[model samples]
Target: MELIQKVLDQPVAVSQPASLRPYNSKLKVHDQILCGKIMHSNFSKLAYSIMQSVGYVHDIRAVLFEYMLL
Candidate 1:
């Protein structure tokens, strides 16, 4: 939880366009779409884990109610 909180609290990091390009390669844009998808999957798992840890609310109905309250 502390690590996740620390990550959330930190300022977003940006990379220079030049640095984002692959070494000696010719892709115009960085693969940000793929990166975003991967991050989304990992974050979803972390959030589910946290939710499970906080309470014995593993049912879909309870999860939805809790999420709605938030």
Candidate 2:
């Protein structure tokens, strides 16, 4: 009963809300690599479609270069 009373008398520790925490803007190495891969995949698909519609085909590297220029 005494131990229980002591515990009860102690104050509870409250954690701050998530919104109060600072945001981490940095991405991990693996996360950065994955994002790059996803972006490259999307750009490749878009370039391929555009080339097909134009009745011409070019190297994937050239298409990617054009996209980077824009």
lDDT of 1 by residue, 3-55 (tens): 78754444332234536544332221212211233234454444444444555
Candidates in order have lDDT scores of 0.39, 0.38
- Per-prediction TM-score, please? 0.28, 0.27
Cα lDDT tens digits for candidate 2, 1-70: 6644543444332133324534232222212222344344543444444443454532333444545559
User: Model 1: clashing residue pairs?
Assistant: none
Winning candidate number (TM-score): 1
Backbone clashes counted, model 1:
0
- Against the true structure, candidate 1 has what lDDT? 0.39
lDDT, residue 32, candidate 1: 27
